[model samples]
Target: MKVKTLEKLAKDMIDYIINLSGFEHIEDIQLNVVDNLESGDMAECNYNDSHGYIQLNIASNMINDIEQAKYVISHELGHILTREFHTYYVNFVGLDDDDMTSICSNVYEQTAEILAKRLGRLILKLYEQKDK
Candidate 1:
């Protein structure tokens, strides 16, 4: 699907962050989860400050494809919600990959990732509602 279509889930995810994290003023940025990438589990990413996105490979291993998929979503949300959730990993000690699994992980990132997971669970709570 087009990135433009994710506005609803993105908004719901953001609200999930605020309600679960009890923070406010978190902007509803753009994000997309495409079926791309290979190896390992799911991967989260951000770009252009305007198009914050998470790309997950539907064919990934069960470790990430099933149970841990939320981490990918939450991890990506971690990037948008806080700067500290990822660790800056340079391919050769310089520029970082957009899929910086540990790119900007700070204390705030930890909190945000945790909150993202919590919100993910809540997504199940309101999953049917989103369709209604």
Candidate 2:
């Protein structure tokens, strides 16, 4: 995906994450745009006891398609919302043109993706509603 499109997706997804987390005071989530990332995926997140941010790499050639892109965002959102390790986030995001099936490392990751998808759907619906 183009940097501009990826940037918009990242922002929208992060806003959804913040709203879903319901941490009223801590609503400032961030998204980073990188030309290249170690993982040939669309997004990644690093979270810990203190602070964290989600990084979306626009250079990932695999995200050229839209469905892959949606899964990528949902997977990354899983990392932030589920607090999964930054370890497997790369696979979670998948490649832009790669398979849509999830690459979950563990049960928690699977769980997170499930929840992220559900929440992501709701958020996107709301976004669409407002667009009308």
Candidate 3:
């Protein structure tokens, strides 16, 4: 797909998810489709809590089509939705140079991944239903 078309789809998906997910307080969300990410990741989301904004970057070369783009974007959205849980878990358990801390971090990542897959499918289903 073309870059412009991909960007528009991503933006629309983001807006739809935020509106349905009670994330209306988020004032700004920018999408960047880059050639590559320094971390070699498919996508990443950078959120500035103080500014109430999120910068979502997707590696253009990594995504092949609309389905992949939807999944990648929703995964980042999953991170945003689950930030509070991650923070609470980290704060409650405390972070240090320990195996437990590493485990906790892994758990948080896995949680986001799981939520992303489910949320992506749900969003698509709901969107289709709405169209009907």
Candidate 4:
């Protein structure tokens, strides 16, 4: 699909997820489809705590289809949604910021990936049901 189309898809998915999940506190959500990311990542989500908004960046070249795009978008959203739980688990385990090295970050990433996959499947199911 075209870059503009992908951007629109991302925005629509974000709105759908927020409405379905009743996720609040986000003042705005921005979507950017870039040729490539500096980190060589397919997609990334940056949350601005001060502004209560999220910046979602997707590497246009990395997305091959609508399904892949949705997965990437949902995965980034997963990061935003699961952040609090990840922090709580880290603290409950008596780990401080200093202890959050690559390993800790990897754990959080894995958790986010798992949750994102589940969420993506659920969203697809719900969306299909809604149309039926």
**Stretch of 10 with least lDDT, candidate 3:** 93-102
* Order of the predicted models by TM-score, top scorer first: 3, 4, 2, 1
- Tell me how many clashing residue pairs each candidate has: 12, 3, 0, 0
TM-score per candidate, in order?
A: 0.36, 0.55, 0.75, 0.73
How much does candidate 3 score in TM-score?
0.75
What are the lDDT figures for the candidates, one per model?
0.44, 0.56, 0.71, 0.71
Per-residue CA lDDT of candidate 1, range 1-132, in tens? 233334344456556655766544354444444445455335444433223333222222323332344344444554544432322322233333353466443443456567666655555444334446
lDDT of 2 by residue, 1-132 (tens): 677777776677667556766744334345666666777655665443334444434444557766666666765555555444443454454333244444444554556667767756765555445437
CA RMSD of all predictions: 7.9, 7.7, 3.0, 3.4
Model 1, position 44, has a per-residue lDDT of 49
| lDDT accuracy of residue 124 in candidate 2 | 53
- Kindly list the per-residue Cα lDDT of model 3 for residues 1-132, writing each as its tens digit: 466766887778777777888875656677887778897998887755556566888887777888877767766777766666645665686544356458776776677678767766777666546557
Model 3 gets an lDDT of 0.71
TM-score of 1: 0.36
Candidates arranged by lDDT, highest first:
3, 4, 2, 1
For candidate 2, the lDDT comes to: 0.56
Local error of candidate 3 at 120, Å? 2.4
Better of 2 and 3 by lDDT: 3
Q: TM-score of model 4 relative to the true fold?
A: 0.73
Greater-TM-score candidate between 3 and 4:
3
